[model samples]
Target: MELVVARIGRAHGIKGEVTVEVRTDEPEVRLAPGAVLATDPPGTGPLTIETGRVHSGRLLLRFSGVADRSAAEALRNTLLIAEVDPQETPEDPEEYYDHQLIDLDVVTRDGTEVGRITEISHLPYQDLLVVARPGGGEVLIPFVHEIVPEIDLAEQRAVIDPPPGLLEEPPGVDGADGADGAEDGRR
Candidate 1:
C-alpha cells in the first residue's frame, strides 16, 4: 500500500531543509533518514531523506540531492508517499490505515443501509468517511468512535450511529412540513 507520510511545507533555510506537515502516525519509522519516498506529481521523486529534525512541534527534513532553499521551495505542497507491506499494521490496535477503511459498507447500528465508504478524508483535526449514499450523492461521516461505533473489517462493514438529521434532510424545509406550521405565509 502506498501511504502519504508528509507534505512538504515552506523552505526552512538556505540549506535545503524544509518543514513538513506529518501525516502518518509513525513518523519516526516512515520519515527517517535514508527513506526513499515516491512523489505524487509522478516524475518529481523518488526522493531520499538525507536528514531530519524536529523544531517547534513540526518535522523538518532535507532530501538527498536537494541542497538549497530554491530546490526545497519547488517541492512545496508535495506529498511524500511510502510503500508499505500490506501485512503490516499500525502499532496501535485502534489505529487504521486509510486503505483499510475505504470501500467498507456503511450501515446504521439498527441495520439501516447508509452507503459504502468511498474515501477517507484526513483532516488536521479529524478523519471523515466519505460515504457513497444508496440514494445517490454522498455524506461525510465523522470517523469518531461515538458516531462510528463499530468497524467490522472481517465483514467489510462500518456501523454508524449518526445524529438526527445527519443522514437525510431535516424536518420543515424544501416542502417538508413541520408537525406544526403557522397556518399560512401570513403567519
Candidate 2:
C-alpha cells in the first residue's frame, strides 16, 4: 500500500533543505534518514532522504543530490509517498491508518446511524473524520477518544458518543435560529 507521508514546502535554506508538512503519525519511522519517497508529479523523485531536522516546529528534509535552494524549491507542494505492507499495522493498537478508518459505519452509542467515514482530515491540532451522511450531506466528526469511543475493525463500525449538538446543524439554518437559552431576545 502506498501512503502519503508528507508534502514538500518551500526551501528552508540555501543548502537544499525543504520544509515538509507531515501527514503520517510516525514521521521518525516513515520520514527518517535514508528513506526513499516517491513524489507526486511522478518524475521528480524517488528522492532519498539524506538528513532530517526540526526547525522552529517544522520538519526540514535534505534530499540526496538536491544541492541548492532552486532544486529544493522545485519540489514544493509535491507529496511524498511511502510504501507499506498491507498486513502491517501500527505499533500502537489504538492507532489506525486512514485506510482502515475509511468506509467504516459511524453510529451513536444508542445505535443511531450517523454516516460512513469518507476521509480523514489531518490538521495540526487533531484529525477530523469526514462522514458522508445517509440522507446526503457531510459532517466532520473530530476523531478523538472522547468523541469516538470505539473502533470495531471486525464489526466495520465506529461507535461515537457525540456531545449534545455535535451532530446538529449550525445556527440559522433551515429556520434554526439557535435559540437555546436566549429565548427572550437576550444576547
Candidate 3:
C-alpha cells in the first residue's frame, strides 16, 4: 500500500531545495533524510530525501542529484509515495490514514443508507469525507467525531450522525421548497 507522503512545491532557492506540502502524519519517518520514495507519473522518482526541515510551517527538502533550481522546479506537483504496511495504524487511534477511510459504507445511526466514502479531503482546519451518494451525487461530510461517530473497519462502514439539512436540500434555496408566493399566499 503506497501512501503519498508529500508533493513537491516550488523551488525555494537557486539550490535544489524545494518546498513540500506534507501529506503524511509520520513525516519524521516517511519524509526523513535518506528515505527513498516512489513518484507518481511512473518514472520521475525513486527520489531520496537528502535533507528535510520545517521553514515557516512548510516542509522543505532537498534530493540527491537534484542540485540546481531548475531541477527542483521541474519536480513541482510530483507526489512522493511511500510503501506502508496495511496492518500499521497510527499511534493515536483518532488519527487515520486516507486508505482506511475511503470506500467505507456511510449510513445513519438508524441504518438509513447515506453514501459511500470515495475520498478524504484534507484541509488546514479539518478533514472531509467525499461521499458518493446512491442517488448519483456527492456530499462532503465533515469528518469529525461528533458527526461521524463510528468507524467500523471490520464491517467496512462509517456511521454518521448528520445534522439537519446535511443530507437534505435546503428548504428555501432557489425556491426549492416550491412555495414561490409570499407567506400570506397572495402572490
**Residue lDDT tens for model 2, 63-120:** 9999999999999999999998877889899999998999999999999999999999
Question: How do the predictions measure up, each by TM-score?
Answer: 0.83, 0.90, 0.88
Q: By TM-score, how accurate is candidate 1?
A: 0.83
Best lDDT among the predictions, by candidate number: 2
User: Which predicted model would earn the best TM-score?
Assistant: 2
Better of 1 and 3 by TM-score: 3
User: On a 0 to 100 scale, what is the lDDT of residue 46 in model 3?
Assistant: 92
lDDT (tens digit, per residue) of candidate 3 on 42-109? 58889999999898998999999999999999999999999999889989988888999889999999
lDDT of 2: 0.94
Off by over 4 Å in 1: 170-187
Model 3 has how many clashing residue pairs?
0
Model 1 agreement with the true structure over 15-95: per-residue lDDT tens digits: 999999988868899999999999988777999999999988889999999999999999999999999997787878788
lDDT of 2 at 15: 99
Clashing pairs in 3: none
Ranking by lDDT: 2, 3, 1
Between prediction 1 and prediction 3, which has the larger lDDT?
Answer: 3
Q: lDDT for model 3, please.
A: 0.91
lDDT of each: 0.89, 0.94, 0.91
